[model samples]
Target: MNNGTPHNTTGTMSANVSYYNENFVANSKFAIVKYSDRFFLQACMAFEGVSQYIDFWIPANIPGDGSIIELSLAANGGNLASYSRFPDGVALRARSGRLLMKYDWQTKRMEGNFSFEIQNGSTIVQISDGTFDLTGIVDGVSNSSIYGVGTFTAYSDQLGSFEAQEVSIELKDRSHVGLPNYWQIIGRMEKPEFPHPQRSHIALQVVEHVETKIHTLGNNPDAWASYFQEPDVGIIPAVNGTLEFTTLPNTGHTEGRLDADFRTAENVLIHVSGIFDIKQAKR
Candidate 1:
């Protein structure tokens, strides 16, 4: 797979905090190229030993002559905005805001001003006089991955037990300022020529963890497992499962085990279990 590169540019960001009734200035400001067409902008501000930050995404096709963009939580309306006041461990989504953007064609830079209100339940936080001046804006792809060697074995009620011929893991970090860092681990186990009818391929996603922990699947949005079979069975999703990481990715290695129960459309329950020890490969 072709992994992308992350672009970080220097900038300055500042705002007025309503909760503390103080002017906030960020010590670190940057924009990450999240994709070829999108950028993740962030500003980290610290006040009284507590860290707070504001972030949002912007499209690659921003207007150069200063256009006002609406920031909201609407599904189809505007760009999303997020506010994090740390040690609090909760991120608030903006209910309403505005972003004014100006792109410099000559210097390949971006300048913007914004103000937003984010609310968690009944408590609302207001941010005002927000401004940022970023330089060296370059468009690029955002994520990098390192492949790992591993073994995966599983058993199903409908197809019995099988071992994957090829097992690989991909680690993608999606951390932003003011939020706890987490890695999105993608594990793939495949045996294309396996004799079993529905035991050819399996994929798992483990999201939101930086250390070894037990992750619950099925109704959990952060973790899940899936499998695919040819011809008739499309993709089956796990209804319940548990993924336990004994050792997380560090120093070029990781170890984990998984047990997942997948329910097919035909009402068949498939159980899968596997253990994996992966060594990261040199890129």
Candidate 2:
């Protein structure tokens, strides 16, 4: 389904896609396309669990550098942020600021940097010094190999917010025979508090597949989580205080939201919240 660029297509002459491009499937395509009097940007990228996206009203033309363009959750009855996980985004507005769009019409490229603010009821995302480029974006649909995606984010009262250096969430049932747990969400970060310069890895689990709910470690073995690291420091059988999926679970997709606060018998806290949509392992 790699249909190539939009160079030969009608009204799609000027288009490009800039993304991680890790998977060859449809999920790998993150694009921006503009034609006639509207701009459309759609992305499935992630900053760990907190994804930044736009799927709604964008001004029809370039406002030039050092100018501001208002963003609306509803314009012409269309949700600009169609992919946002926030519950209420109509009130989500940006900070009064200008985005410097250094666009090049001849090259069909656009680049800019701006930091804005938006909120969905109580959930707020302060887009800190965000930058974007659509010099090589896409203007076509994808194949049928991809589906839903999830989100993850976490905060600590003890320490500031942090993101995982790596994330690997999967279905334990696919890897383990007779394993009761249905899902395994794992993340890792650097830990200087430990003995050596090793990374701290945490993995959480849930017994049911319908949703990811908070579960205490000792309550039952059906739904639980654990933590460990390299060099065998110590292991912590853990519990989750908050866990949620962005949407209801369905077949062929495993994307949802997650927030977990787990600890060891030594009271070491391992907190993580993010979104994921890793495909179910092949049967």
Candidate 3:
């Protein structure tokens, strides 16, 4: 049984599936089905030159809208399974794995990053850096029609380089009593890390009639960035850095670059530099 559109529209699913030390940029299809009392979210993908496909099933009752769901066989009323086809046309079921899924109810889209292991007798297939995005689950109309593509990458000496699996950028124009009237750019990057996920943030303010080629970290009050690692390592503020905007903030979109250096409480050096292209959210 299906309430709304059961299958996804064409070109609505984007996914990358990796296993056996090989990566596949697959064409995917997704569906929302109701069986008995539970609603299931299912997806299947097919790659080029291979008879292999990966499938996943999850309960739709789990909380969404920027909430994280850790998938397990006993999760709610549904389980996560992956079927991979081999060269000899033999299919193997994933034995154990970890999956983290995030979704937005208003946008009708889902984002997932997962890694799992499949063992068959003496052979083990390792799946790593697997990611997928499924959109237009309700009416078969893409959410990207209303929202633009946003992506960013952050690199540091301590944490290496990581691309944000999900990115959000917001623009604010406000005037405080004591502070100057300015336009603020706020950005967040969500990185997929098993067990504990990490987030990086960028904040910059541009006051009216402030002319500067580069903004320094300590010298500037309106520019700053931070890294957040919960519990073990708290928020690490930038010690020294520079921020430059290639494309100034506007009502439509903003493009910029940031190079920041941070030092954790334990004296670990983190030199972060990356570029961002984000669309302004509708107000």
Per-model TM values vs. the true structure: 0.52, 0.33, 0.41
Candidate 3 Cα lDDT to native = 0.53
Ranking by lDDT: 1, 3, 2
Full-model lDDT, candidate 2: 0.40
Q: Each candidate: what lDDT?
A: 0.59, 0.40, 0.53
Q: Which candidate has the top score in TM-score? A: 1
| Per-residue alpha-carbon lDDT of candidate 3 for residues 46-156, written as tens digits (9 for 90 to 100) | 333343445565555767677988876321223544544422222333456767888777776777777655543355666666776666554323344233357777687
Candidate 1, position 177, lDDT = 36
lDDT of 3 at 187: 49
Please tell me which predicted candidate would have the highest lDDT against the true structure: 1
**Winner of 1 and 3 under lDDT:** 1
Q: What shift in Å separates residue 218 of candidate 2 from its native position after superposition?
A: 4.8
lDDT of 1 by residue, 123-202 (tens): 56687888887766555532345555766666766655656665556654434333333343344343345453232566
- The per-prediction tally of clashing pairs is 0, 19, 0
Model 3, C-alpha of 277: deviation from truth (Å)? 1.5
Give the residue spans of candidate 1 off by over 4 A: 1-8, 20-22, 32-34, 46-49, 65-76, 143-244, 250-281
RMSD of model 3 against the true structure: 18.9
